[model samples]
Target chain A: EAGVAQSPRYKIIEKRQSVAFWCNPISGHATLYWYQQILGQGPKLLIQFQNNGVVDDSQLPKDRFSAERLKGVDSTLKIQPAKLEDSAVYLCASSPRGGGGNEQFFGPGTRLTVL
Target chain B: DQQVKQNSPSLSVQEGRISILNCDYTNSMFDYFLWYKKYPAEGPTFLISISSIKDKNEDGRFTVFLNKSAKHLSLHIVPSQPGDSAVYFCAARGFSGNTGKLIFGQGTTLQVKP
Candidate 1:
């Protein structure tokens, strides 16, 4: 089976600009997630989607970040008026249903660099 | 607050030696623990996992030991090889219905010398 796929392995944008990242999870996976990994830190969960519905997004910055999983197969994460602090790698992962020790499969991730 | 913590930022060990990485978690709700290995420019891959019900889990050269009383878990690699040089992250799963969301700790970078 193929792994999770993401677009634009790398991106560069200016401060106050807008940027979007897209992710296509593995086929038949029911859960998807987006995370941000800053330099020298662990990846922080930004949002999680179970099928077409959101399961958790409490840590996400509502003012500037938003994400959606349109048909439960693919998802997109957007950041408007990007800040310098937002410069980090955005990772996407997917897992099967029922969640009984199912390991998540991660994508290559989009490395966003905000100048 | 950082629920999970990996105190060591980096470790270096000679090949064929033993490597031990430690992690501590403050939350008692975490019922499952996992370890992931990551290479530069690549996403993390699942290495091993252990449920709170079990104190230890081993696969090949990688072994994970959990101590519920101390709220600590550790990964030990025997006969470490240069290919094992990478960042290792510890993650925990909380019991919140079907969320299955994992809380991760800051990773430890391991360098194995030949």
Candidate 2:
């Protein structure tokens, strides 16, 4: 079975520029998630989508970050006016369901470097 | 607040020895715990998981032990191989008022020498 797929793999952008990352979840997966992993830190949940509907995005910075899963199969995360602090790896993950106790499958991630 | 924490940043062990990674969580509502292995430039892969009701779960040479009373958990690898060298992350599920989100630790980088 194929795992979650992400685009770019690596990206570089200047501060104040806009950047977008794409994610395609595993086949038949019902839940998708976006996370940010800074250097030396664990992945931090940015947003979650359950079949095109947002399940949770409380930790996301509404002022600069936004994410959407329009058709439920693919999703995109965008950051506008990127700051130096936005330099981190963006990971996408999927699961069979959106409930607890299910293991999430992760993608290779997009490493974003904001200069 | 950081709910989950891995105090050790790195560990080194010889091949065929035992590798123990520890994790502590402050939240009592976590219903599930998981360990993920990650290599440089690669995403984390699910290694093993254990539910709160079960104290121990083993898969191959990897064993996870949970202590609810102390809110601590550990991942043990026996006869560790060189391929086992990677960053191990401890994650917990079931945050109150959250929807199936996982809280992860800083991770511990393990090195198994040949």
Candidate 3:
């Protein structure tokens, strides 16, 4: 089976510039998630989508970050006026469904470097 | 506030020896816990998991023990291999008004020497 797919494995942008990351989850997966992993730290959940509907995004910085899963299959996370601290790897994951113990399969992630 | 924490930033063990990584969580609502292994430049991969209903769960050479009273959990790898060198993260899932979301620990880097 194919795994979760993400684009632009690496990215670099100047501070205050806008950047976007794309993700295409595994086929038939009902739940998708976006996470940020700063260097030397674990992945932190940024947002979750269950079939195109947001399940949770409390940890997301509403002022600068936004994400959307259109058609429940492809997702995009965007950051505007990026800060230096936003330099981190952005990961996308998918599971069979939501509200269970199912394991999530992660993509290689997009490493964003804000200069 | 950091809900989950892996205090040990790093650990080194010789090949064929045992490796133990510890993690602590402060949230009492966490009902399910999981361990994930990650290599440099790669996303984390699910290693093992345990539910609150059980105190211990073992799979092959890996075992996870949970102490509810102390809010601690551990991962044990027996006869460790050099290939096992990677960062290990502990994650917890609970009803924080969101059923499937997970909170992750900072992570512990384990280096197994040959």
Candidate 4:
């Protein structure tokens, strides 16, 4: 079985520029998530989608960050006018369903560098 | 407020010894806990998990112990090998309706020397 897939394994952009990251979760997965992992820190959830419907986005920066899962299969996370602090690895993960103890499968995150 | 924390940033252990990585969480509503291992430039992979109802869960050589009263959890790797060197993260899930989003702690880096 194929694991989660993400594009643009690495990205470099200047501050104040716009950037976007994409993610394609495993087949038949019902839950998708986007997380931001700064250096030396664990991942923080930015947004979560349950079959195309957003379930949680409390930690997301509404002013600059936005995410969408049109068909619930693939997702896109965007940051406008990126800041230096926005430089981090954007990881995408998915699970079979929303429940306790369900293991999440992660993708090779996109390393974003904002200069 | 940081809900989950791993006080130790790094630890070194000799091969064939046991490596214990500790983590503490502040939220009492957290009902499930998990451990994830990550390598440089790669996403975290699930290692083990334990429910709040249970104090211990073991899988192969990996074991996780949870102390709900203290809000502390730990991961233990026996007979540590060089391959076990990586960053381990602790995650917790709160009982917030249908949202199962996990809150993670700062990772602990383990270095096992032969």
TM-score of chain B of each: 0.97, 0.97, 0.97, 0.97
Show pairs that collide, candidate 4. Answer: none
How does each model score on TM-score?
0.97, 0.98, 0.97, 0.97
Candidate 4 CAPRI classification by DockQ: medium
C-alpha lDDT of residue A37 in model 2? 98
Q: What is the lDDT of residue B57 in candidate 2?
A: 99
Pick the winner on DockQ between candidates 2 and 4.
Answer: 4
Against the true structure, whose DockQ is highest?
Answer: 4
- Candidate 1 off by > 4 Å: A98-102
Over the stretch B4-113, how does candidate 3's per-residue lDDT look in tens digits? 99999999999999999999999888889999999987888999999988999999999999999999999999989999999999999867565667889999999999
Question: What digit string (tens of lDDT, one per residue) describes model 2 on residues A35-114?
Answer: 99999999999998889998898899999999999878999999998999999999999999986454699999999999
What lDDT score goes with residue A51 in model 3? 97
Question: What are the runs in model 2 whose C-alpha is more than 4 Å off?
Answer: A100-102, B96-98
DockQ-derived CAPRI band for the predicted complex in model 3: medium
RMSD (CA, Å), each prediction: 1.2, 1.0, 1.0, 1.0
True contacts kept of 4: 0.74
Total clashing pairs for each candidate: 0, 0, 0, 0
lDDT of 2 by residue, B1-114 (tens): 999999999999999999999999999989999999999989999999999999999999999999999999999999899999999999999653657888889999999999
What TM value does chain B of candidate 2 have? 0.97
State the lDDT of candidate 4 residue by residue for B8-114, as single tens digits: 99999999999999999999988899999999878899999998999999999999999989999999999899999999999998755777778899999999999
User: Cα deviation of B23 in candidate 3 (Å)?
Assistant: 0.4
CA shift of A51, model 2, Å: 0.2
- Fnat values, one per model, are 0.49, 0.68, 0.65, 0.74
